[model samples]
Each structure stands twice: as structure tokens, then as C-alpha cells.
Target chain A: MIMKQFRFEPLAQASYLIGCPRAKEAVIIDPIDDLGAETYVLEAADLGLTITGVFETHVHADYISCARELAEMNDVPHYLHESATDLVQYSFTPFKDGQVFEVGGVRIKTLHTPGHTPEHTSFLVTDTARTDEPWCVLTGDALFVGDVGRPDLLLGDQALDVMDEATRAETLYRSVKDRLFALPDHVEVYPCHYGGSTCGGVNMSGKAASTIAFEKRFNLAMRKDTPEAFAAFVKETAKPFPDDYARIKSYNLGLISKDAITEAAV
Target chain B: MKPTEVQDAVAKGAVVLDMRPPKPFAKEHVPGAVNFQFNRADLAERAEMSLPQDLTYIVHAEPDPIAKVAIGILSKAGFSVDGYLEGGLKQWKADGLPTEALPLLTVDELKDGLDRYHVVDTRESFEFRFGHVPGSTCLEWTEPWDQMEGLESEKPLALVCGDQVRSAYVASVMQRAKMDAALVFGGMVDWLERGYPVEKSPKKAKAPRI
Candidate 1:
């Protein structure tokens, strides 16, 4: 499997294109704005590959996502957790938590990692050609380089009532410890954001990727602590909310379609 | 010049004349300094309104080129332009001279004042639409200078913009026009970081309306 990581410097976001050479098939994770999608597609075409799936872990607040547009343009499936169906405005294939699928020889498993948002999911992909153990987990907003997603964004009476600020923080803790950490220490962790992002505070080392063991030891959000302490810590340092959050959320809820977005040059 | 020389001059009753634009002077300038605009055509009239004919004016700008222009203008006007601020206001500040408050709002302060103050964003119309202090009245920076009529000049008008420089200049202009106003100290970024309330202009749908 050949994995290509594209970093959008403005928001410090990372998107990925993972391809299986034997099958000439590929999948993209959390594609950013249309510019990002265009670059990814051009690169894939140059490599003589076809993208079969475009995945979104959650509705992003920092920048607009081009997942819907990329999927529609390429005539490929867009996948997200089933709960995200109501949250996202576009059409997509909804996978239940723990659902498994195979692309070429790679076995891709989806884990419902819901703390960042009600329907957040992370994919653990196993390269059968390399090893039975999963090689790397693509953690979207749920897990970042050093910090977990801020839970307060999902709060308020209108959104998911079950995932209150406190409950979301606790769920995030469990997602990091029980699910992500339960995997082998050697499993590499790839996250969507690094430090300097307004989404979360105090990211780990600002590196694009890390091992499970390294995060367990160094990630302040993942360090062994009481759920209450973790929640309090996150609450105290929660970053100033992004200025574009409400617009992004509404757009994700499908009130706005991809074609509705009018890109402007900054 | 050395710090001691500045101190000695102050001790000898040397006047500290701030030649920066009015907005910055209003935000926080040396307490006793009077404003003198370098670009104003009726500088003699403005000077006659502020300073006595016999006083030796020590002209100072934020830095050199501005100070030179101020000195040249005052000298031409037949006022005794004693000397210039060596490094301008910043250097004077670095030397620990007393400065006064212009009292500009950070984003947090603007948020806190959502219920009380009528914030006025003095940035350009394009920037105002991006984001501004919530409940602020948009007065484009290019708005005619005389349109400031009827508003209570003493009612603590808060001037806000993307940064301090423009607001400072505007404040100085306001002060010269004999109006009372204050500059928002750190500008919009500082205000937003402190979790202040910002109202997006209605024209820009991409930005948030706080």
C-alpha cells in the first residue's frame, strides 16, 4: 500500500490518499476544499489509479471539506458512520460501528470514535500483503497529534443530547484508551491535525504521525488520569471557537450542497 | 540620545509633543503631550487651538521620518520646534516614560460590552464584513471626517479595527476635531482570542455572525 499525505498549511489539516498497487484502487481520507480534491485526483490519475471511496470522519469546523465533490466527480462512494447521515447534507454510504470491508487485499475496519462529534469514526486498515495486524489507524478529529477534539463544539440543546460536553469528553477518553490504545503499540497513528490548530489546545509534538505507545506516554489527552480531570483540563483550555463553525455545521447537515459553495480567491 | 538626556530635558520642562495620528494618541500617549498632525494643511490653526504662541514645542513622532516632517512643519509655522523624539514614542516608552490609556477593547472586552457599549468599527467596509465587534456601527475609514456630527463626542466612543495603527490615526483625527474617543487597544485578533463577541458583517455570508 502506498500512502500519500497532503498537508493544508492554512488550517494545519492533513488528508490522505492510500492506494493498493496490485488492484489499482485507492481511498481518500478527509479530503479538504475543492483545491485539495483537485490536486489529489490529478495525482491519482497520473498514477493510473481509480479512487473507490472518499471518507469523512466527522463534520470539520476549521475548513470546508471537498469529500462530497470529489466522490461525486469521480463517481465513487462517500462513506461515513450511519449517525452522520442526518448530519451530512450529501448522499453517502453509512457504515455501522465495527463494520469491516476489503479494498483489493487491504482489510479496512471502521471504529465509531464518537467524542469529537456524535458520529465520528476512525478507520483501522490492515495491509494483508504486509501483516495481519493493522498497519495504521486514520484518526480524524477524534484524535490529533497531541490533543483530542474539543467536546464543547457538539454541545447545546439542538445537537446530540446524549453527547453532552462532559459525556463527550469521557467518551473521548474511552475511545483513546480502550479502543485506540488496546491495539498493538507498534500500530502507527495518523491524525488529521497538528499543533497551531484552533480546534484543540496543546497538541503533542506537531508531527503528522506517531505510534500508539508514544501517544500513550506523551499525549496529554491520553495520559492516565481520571475522566473528570481530563474533562476539566480540556474545558479549561478549550480554544476560542472557530469563526466559521456554525456555517460549516449547517453545510455538513446538507442544507448546502457542494455545488452551492462558491470558492473565492483569498 | 541617552536616557539621562531625555530625563534631563523633561526635568527642564521640555514639552513632549506627540505627532502620531490622533487615534493612537488617544489610546495611550505620553500624558502631557499635545497632538500635532504633520499632514494637516491648517496646522497653524490647529496649533493655535492647542499650544500657546510662546511655548517651545518638542515635536515627536513614532520614529524618525515622521518626526522630521513634524519638526519641519512646525518650524515653517514660526513655532519654536525645539527637538525631535530620538526614536519616537516607542523608544520613549522603552525608556520608561509614563504613557496614558487610549483604552481600546480586545475581543473579550468587546464581548463583555455586548450589552452596554455601542462599538464602532472604523476599518474599511470589506474588513468590517469579515468580522467586527458585535453590535458595532460600521463607519468606513474613508467616511467623510465631518460626518461625526450629533454623536456625543464625550460619550466614550470606542474605535476598533484589525490593528492599532489605523485606529490610532483615526483617534488622533477625532481628538484634533475636538471629539472624545478611545482606540481599541490590541484590535480584533486580541479580542477574538479572548473569546469576545464579534458580529460578522451581513454582506459576507462565509464569515460568522456572532
Candidate 2:
């Protein structure tokens, strides 16, 4: 199995390309607009792998996703959480929780870890050539380096009907503590954002990667003994939404054209 | 058994048991290989139905660990599993042994060629009852040869399940018996995802918990 992390320092966003060398097939996760489709395709070709599938953790409120562009270019399937059926205008293969997609000896299993955004998902990846046990989890924005994703992204946004801040925080807490934390301690953690990214709380570590055990022991968000306390902690660490948060989200949902967002920025 | 030894075993009338799912087996496999997918639950039952005890067997599965587990399962199930092929199918291919393939029909193809095939849903009875391909006949994986024998032999049997794994296993078994069979890639899940119509059982029945 071969894994590559493409980190966009400008947005503090990280995307991954994982593939099975023997099968010569790869899947891109949470591709960002900055890097574009060609970057993934060219890199995969250089590595002797064909881009077989594209996956999105969720509709990003922070930035535009290149999932559609990449998937279309390769004529591969774009996989997203099934809950996004009504929200997303683009074509995708809606994946349910526990759905497994295999690329040669590497198997990717989906875990619906909502709360960061209602349709948020984390991918549990196993390299069957090495072992059946998952070697690492692509946590998306649910579980970060030292903190959790800001559940308050949708707090005051009225463009879409979404969960309130309090409910989202509580749900995010359960998603982290109950679901993500249940992974074996040794499993490596790779998240979409780190410190300096508004998507995560203030305490998020700048370190790109950590382990499940390390985060469980030291993450401030997980230290809370109860969900109520966890919610309170999450709410307190909320950051101000970016000026174009709604538009960026809308762009991701295909609600508005990319040209509209770019023109608005100019 | 090593790839070099596969021919010797075959010459002596030993069957090559391919433990991988039907998809890979259908794509390419040691000619005359029988597929009985390796899994913990019901391995013994499925083996009993799919395999003949009279012949000695050579187990073949990819990734050495799974092949090891398959050998253990076959041994415990009271079958004569001589040994597993070292380095699995990769090594077998590297050794340049001849292989064969079965048809792997996509949902789109199945949709277009519905009239030409006999669709068989290999999912559980309750799952089949809940929703299934309009004309598919439900025959769960564990169903015996007598049940499969009732299938329309005139038309090519197209096997399908939730995902294609179970269907692929069933396809391999049918192919071993010289039946004209094809594995429905992406299975019923793909069919439903494509918004294809399905026929549900008139009476709603609860699926039994495993």
C-alpha cells in the first residue's frame, strides 16, 4: 500500500492519496480546489497508479472541493455520504456507513462520524497485504490533532437548515468519544485540518499526524467527562465564521457556480 | 502447495480451492479452480455444499495471512487441504501458469441484457423479500445444489448479492460445475443506487438477527 498526503498550507487543509501498489489503483480523499484535479492525476500516474475513485469527507464550509472535477476527469465514481443526496446537486455514489470499497489489497471502510457537518465521514483504511487491521484513519474534520472540528460552523447560517450549535457540539462529542476513539490505540490519525485552520478549535496541534492513544490522552476536547461539559467546552472555543463561509459551502453543494464565488472574491 | 506443484497436484486429480471472492476468481484464476470464499462463519457449511470430500485440495488465497487462515478452516472442517499455495495467485501468475476467466457483467449491462440472462439473487431470504431485482430468484449462498439445479440452464445465470462478493463466490461454484454463469458486479446495491425498479414481497417480513 502507498499513501501520500497533499497539504495545502494556505488553507491548512490536507488531502490524501492512498493506493495498492499491486492493483495499481488509488483513491483520493477530500481533494481541495487549490491543488486541482490534474495534480492528483499526474501524481498518481507518476507513481504507476490509476485514479480509480474520489471521496469527500463532507461538503466543506471552509473551501471548495475538487471531488467533482477529479472524479469526472478520470471517469471514476465520486463517493459521498448518503445523507448528502438532497443537498448536493452533483452526481455521486452515496455511501452508507460500514460500506467497504477495496482497491487491490487496500480496503477502505466508511464510518459515519457526523456532527462536524451532518454528513461528515471518516475512512478506516486497511492494507490487507500487511494486515487486516486498519493502519490509520482519515478523520476528516471530526477528530483533529489536539482538538475537534468546530461544530458551530452552521450556528448562525440561515441559507440552509442545520443543527443548532448546542446539538452539533453534543453530537460531535459523541462522534469523537464514542466512534473515533473506539479505534485501536496504535492506529494513526490523519485529519483534514490542523492548527491555524478555523475549522478546528484553538487548541488544535500544528502537527499533521498523531496516534489514537496520543490524542485520547492529551486532546483537550476529549478530556471532558460528560457530553454536556464537552458541549460547553466546544461552544466556548468556537471561532468567527469566515466572511464567505455560506457561499463557500453553497459552492461545495453546487448551489452556486465556482465562477460566482471567484467573482465575488474579486 | 507452490505454483510449480499446482500442475502435479492437478495431474493427480487434486482440486485447486480458490478462497478469494468470485470477482477476482472470475477475472483470472488457475484453470479448473473451485472458489469457496474464506470467512469465519458458515465456511464449513458452504464448503460442504460446494466441495467434494473425495478429492485432495490445494488452497489458494491472496495475501499470505488469509491463505493461512483458510488452510486452518479447511483442516478444522475435516477436508484434505494438502497445503496453501505459497505467495498465492501473484506467485501463480508470476510462474506463468495458464488461467481462465468468467464473465463479470455490470449492472448497466444487466439492465440492457435482462432478457438474455437468468438473474439469481444470492442475498438472505428476508433481504430478497424486502426489495430485489424485479425478476431475480432468491437463492441464499448456503442453499444446496438441488436448489441451484432448479435454475434455468438454458439462459446464462447472472448471480447478484448486496455487494458482489457473495454473488462472485456463487458464480465460481457454478462455473466449476460447467454452468453458464456471470457475476453481477456492484450487485443489487448498484442496481438500487441507479434508481432501478425492484419488486418487493407483498407481505413484509422481519429479517432474523444473526
Candidate 3:
């Protein structure tokens, strides 16, 4: 089994590849655009693995997602939460909460974790050969090592008023406490963002991974103890949204397409 | 790339991007130079979106590697980069050309001059609140476009920011608008870096989402 994390430091974004060498299969989580799927495909082949699927935790608002492009190139399923929309001209394997995907002896379970965006999901990985107990959870935007995802950005231009800020903040509160932290405190935590990311202010630690126990004890949002407190904390600590956030979100949802990438190639 | 060639390019209105931190840029920059300031949050996206593709741009950034990065990004985003400025603004100064800057005055110089000139800080509220040159007013960077009516008529004005580089950017607007504003070199950063006194205020200026 292999879990590799790649960081785009320019934007402070984190992406991952989890693979099973025995099964020669892999999955990518929360991939950003500009980083071509070919790069990952070639890397996987060198490691004796093939990309089996690509999953997104949510429709991101910061940068375009290359999930669709990557999945197309790999001839693998591109998965998103069932509630996510704007599929454009492509198809996806829409998933529901608690759905399980298996590759060899590793079981990947999806947990619908909404807050940053309504369709956000987290994936919990269990090595069934070792134990039914899970080993790690990829908490996308739902949780970071020292901070929870900021929720207010879901409204306004990005979603075109799909939902209000306060409402999503409350959802983020529930998503963190109920869905993500529900796993045992010792579960290894991996997120799609870390320090220097504009997602939050001050509290986000640059550490690669954290135990649920460590986050529970020290993560500012987790320590808030109530939904109201969590909501307030999130609102208070939200950094200015990332640059080109609305446009990037639109591109990710296919409201806009990568004419820029094509233009660059030309 | 020679000083005279740069002057000729400037005469032809070649876009000059001074990619230094705002304070250093403020401390010294070419008159009419555009300070992209490289450190401004979301700089890459903003430059990609706003820079004109048809016009040729010359870049001058510290740490030569960053200048290369700027040229790469600008050219990739369809900007027609003329070339990197040879030796940056330092060469311009050594060549005895007029490098525009707000008079780098001590506190006493600012006190004597603040009332004689329009003084403004170009940083957002959060940064301004941390500390600023005393007696300077907070003006959002886009105030020229949004709040021009409230601004005083173009006069001998002084522009300040956390770094001198930002003031140079604002100075570009003043140059285009025919407003007489000068860059306050060694802005708040230099003020603090030099252990000069700054007025403290208990407020948090949230950075605006650009």
C-alpha cells in the first residue's frame, strides 16, 4: 500500500495518491489543475501501479480541478458527491455517504462531510487484511491539521448565492465534530491544504499529518466545543478568499472551461 | 538594456514592472514604473488577468531569479515581455536619471512636510492598523477609481505603504492621472526596520479578497 502527498507550494495546495501495489491500483484525492494527470500516470507506472479512480472532496473555489481531465486520460472513474452538479460534458460516478470502495485488501469508505461546500466528502481508508479498523482519513477541506475549513466562501460569487455564509458555517461545525472527528482520535489525518493556504488565518500548522487526538486537543476549531462557537471562530478567522476564487470555482464546476490552458498550449 | 535604451523604451510607453517589495520600491523606483510588488497577495492571478497582452513589458525585480519567474509567468499569460531591466533601478540611479521617490525624511522631515503635501497610506485597513507613519491617512488602494471625488486635487502628495514597492504602484496611477504624488520610500517597513516610532492602534484590518 502507498500513500503519497504532493504539495503545490505556490498556492499551498495539497493533493494525494493512495495506491495498492499488490492490486496495482491507485486513487487520487483533491487534485488541482495545471498539474497534468500524465505526470501522475507516469509516476504510478514506475511504481508498478495503475490509477483506478479519482475522487474530489468537494467543488473547490480556489483552483481548477483536473479530476475530469485526469480521469479521462487514465480511463478511470471520476467520482464526486451525488449532490455536486455542473458535470459539463463529462460523466462521473456519483457517490452517497457511507459508500465503500475496495481495491485489493484496502477499503475506502466515503463520509459526506459538508461545510466548506455542500457536497464535500471525506474518505476513510481501512486495511482489511490487517484489521477492519481504519488507518487514515483524507479530510479534504473538512479538516486541516490545526484548523477546520472556512465556510463563508461558499456563498456570493462562487456558488452564485447557492447558500448563505452562516448556514454553511453551521454545517462546517457539524461536519467537523460529527463526521470527521467521529473516527478514533488516533486515525491519521490528511487534508488537501496546510499552512500558508488562504483557507484560514494563523492557526493552520504546516505539519503533513496529525492524529485525530492531536487535532482534537489543539485544533482551534475543534476545541471550540459548540456549533455556535465553531461558527463564530470560523467566521472570525477566515482569511480573505484566495485570488481568482470565484473564477476558479466556476472552472472546477465547468461553469467555465480551461480556454487558458488551451490558449497556452497554442 | 542600457540606461539610455531604457529611457527610450519608457518614452515609447513600454510597461515597466518594478517587482520589488513595496517599501523598497517606494524607497527608490523609476518614475512612471509599475510596481507589481510581487508580494501583493494574489499577484500572479491579478497580473495574469490585468496585464495587457498586446503591450510589451520590461521587468525589474530584485533577486534575479524572481525576475526570471516574473518574465516566465508574464510571457506565459500572453504578456509580451520586452526583457528584464538591466541592473534594475540601481543602474538608473547610478546613471543620474531622475528616480522618483518621496523625500526619505526622518520623523522631523515628515512632521514638517506632512501638512504641505497630501499624505496617504496605500495598504488595507488591517495592515494600516498594525502601525503606519504618523499623520498619514488610510486610503484603499483603489480609492483613485472609487473615491476620487473625495480626494484632494492633485498636489505634491506622498504615498506610503508597508513596503516602498506598493507606493510605486500607486505612483503609477498618479502618473497616469497626472496627479503629483511621490513614493514614500522606506514606508512602514523601513520605519519599523530602522526602529523608528510608529503609532499603534488596536484594530485588525482584514485583507480584502482581490
Candidate 4:
């Protein structure tokens, strides 16, 4: 298994490229932009690996996600949770809660982890060739080091008439406490966003990944077992909402095409 | 030379570089001049950071040859040199021109008295996060009403930036706002050059606590 994490310091975003150099196949998770081509793709080509899958851990609120753009350019299967179809206008294969994808010797299972957002999903990865045991979990915004994702960022966006910050917080609490924590402590956990960032502006960890056991012991959010306590922590730790997050969502949904800006014909 | 010309140039946003050692500079010098040793090691590296590339620079140093050399150093590195003070500080003094100085603090003094003063970084949030004074707050640049919130008008502020250029501007803004804020002399360049500890915010430094 060849796993590399790429972090954009300015945006506090992290993307991953997990490859099977043995099978010459790979996949990317939570990509930020087309800059991946210059970085991970070049690295993949050098390793003689073909990318078979791409994923958006969730519809990003800070910067635009390039999952669709990279998928189109590379002609790979892009996947996202089915729940995001109404909020994001991108075409992708939807992986349900319990679906699993096997690429090369790796088994990537989808855990419909929602809380950071309704469509957020996490992947439990196992190197099947080595053993039946799982290796890691890509937690996305559902969980972070030192803190879990801030669920209150959804406030004031009326597009989701059924969802609000409090409701999101409730869902997030359930997702982290019930769904993600259900995994074994030995499983290595990799999540996007890390320290030195705002509550909403999560960055990547220094080590790139931490053990589920370590996070369970060290993360402040994990200590609070009740959903109410977790939601309160999310509210208290929140920063001023990220600037221009709504408009960036429009770009991700393909509603604001670059062609429209250059006045090019559709 | 007319004093008004120097004032006009300064008013138009030229950085005044004083190339005298700290001892001489402290007694008397240009009102907002930043001091860097005239001939010292790492002067080039310091200049690249502490000095702004955009604005013109007016150098004040000793004798004609040395002053020209100082200007040459900056000019070689793509800095805009508007030229040196024709007669230098001694001549300016002889002409009964205005000169002033403030009580200077070494990094040691600032660290010892850290609690007595406030540290404000004028760098953008990203730059500050890369590394900064642990307890300092950020006020990148300010709007008319910006000071009302982020700034503590009561506390003495020591303003710093990537280079002194932005902080120098911020110092003036603080003055107009009636806030007591001084440039951190050489800014981040000097701080890093001195090898003081820099801190990263946990929000951005999100390593697992365990």
C-alpha cells in the first residue's frame, strides 16, 4: 500500500492518494483542486499506477473541491454520498452506507458517516493481501485530531430547508460517537484538516494520520459521550464562518462554470 | 537640501533606512528610521526581508563613499533607492534639523517585559500561522473602524510584519488612531534573525493531542 497525503497550508485542506504499486492501481480522496495533476498524478505515473476511484468526503465549505474536474480529466470513477445530489449538481457514482470497493489488493469500505454534513462519508481501508484485518480509516470532516468537525457552519444557508446548524450538530454527534467510533482502536485514522486552523478551517495533522485509540483518548470532543455535550463544544469552538463559502459551493456544483467567466460559448 | 523634501518623500511612503549601529542610533536619529548595522554579516538577507521592494528607500549613513556603497547594496538587489541623505545625519544635525529617538528594547527586554506590552502582527493570517509570537493577535492592515475591535487601544502595541514595511505603515495608522504602537524595530526578519522561539496556533497545527 502506497499512501501519500498532500496538504494545502493556505486553505488548511488535505488530499490523499492511496495506491497499490503492486497492482498498478490507485484512488484519491477529498481532492482540493487540479493542482493534483502536477503533484499526485505525476507521482502515480512515475509509480506505474492507474487511478481507479476518486471521492469527495463531503461538499467542501471553504475552498472549491476539484473531485469532478479531476475525475473528468483522468476519466476515473468519481464517488460521493448519494445525499449530496440535491445540494451539489455533479454527476458521480453514489456509494451507499455499506458498499465496499476492492482495487488491487486493497478493500475500501464506505461507512455513511454523516455529521460534518449530510453527505459526508468515511472509508475503512484494508490490505486484503496482507491479512483480513483493516489498516486505516479516512474520517474526512466527521472527525479531526484534538477536535471533531464543527457542524454549525451550515447555519443561514436556506437551501437545505430541512437542515440547520443544530440539526447538523445533532447528526454529527451521532455520526462521530456511533458510526466512526465503532471501528477498532488499532485502525489508523486519517482525516482532512488539522491544528493552527480555525474551527471551520481544519488543516491536516503533522503525522498525517493517528491511531483510533490515540484520538479516542486525546480528542476533547470524544470525551463527551452525550450528543448535547458534543453540540455545545461545536458551538463554543466555532469561528466566524469562512468568507464566501456559499459562492464557492456554487462553483463546486458546476453552477458557476469557468466558461461563463471568459464569456465563451456554452 | 530642504527638510520639506525629506518630509514630502516620507509622506509619499518612502522607507528611511538608518545604517548606524544601535548605540549611535539610540541617542538621536530620524523620527521613524529603522536601524541596521552599516557593515555587518547577513545584511543582505536582512535587507531582502526587513526592507520593502515596492517603495523607494532613502539611506542615511556615514561619509559619501560608505553611504553610496550602502545604497549600491540595496540597488543591486532590485530595491528602489531614491538616493542617500546628501550630508548624512551629522550634516543634518549641523543644519539644526529635527531629530528624535525612542527607548529601544532588545529581544531579551521584550521577552522579560512581555506581559507589560501587546504584540500585534501585521502579516496576513496565513503568514502569521506559519509562525508568530505566541500570544500576539493579528490586525493585518486596518479600515477606519478596524481598530475599534481587533485592537486594544489601551495596551501598548509592538507591531511586526514579514518586513518592517507593512508594520511601518501600521505604526503610522496606530499614531493617527491615538494608539501607542511602535514598529518591532526590524520586524519578523530581526526576530527570526535573533533566533527567538516562534509559535504555531493549534487550530492550524492540528496534530493529534495523544
Report the candidate with higher TM-score, 3 versus 4.
Answer: 3
Quote the true-contact fraction of every model.
Answer: 0.00, 0.00, 0.00, 0.00
Evaluated against the true structure, the overall lDDT of model 2 is: 0.82
lDDT of 2 by residue, B73-148 (tens): 7888889988878876777889988888978899999999999987888888888989988777777876654455
Off by over 4 Å in 2: A155-159, B1-210
TM-score of 2: 0.57
Candidate 4 lDDT tens digits, A98-180: 89888878889999878777888998999986888889999888888767777765535587424777788888878877878
Candidate 3 lDDT by residue in tens digits, A5-119: 8888877788888886445567888887757665565455444455788999988877678898778766679999988854333568899999999976678999998878888
RMSD of each: 24.9, 17.4, 20.9, 22.7
Docking class of 4: incorrect
How much is the lDDT of residue A160 in candidate 3? 52
- Each prediction's TM-score against the native? 0.53, 0.57, 0.54, 0.53
DockQ of each: 0.01, 0.01, 0.01, 0.01
For candidate 4, what's the RMSD?
22.7
| Top of the candidates by lDDT | 2
Judge the docking of candidate 2 as incorrect, acceptable, medium or high: incorrect
lDDT of 3 at A46: 41
Query: How many clashing pairs per prediction, in order?
Result: 17, 1, 13, 16
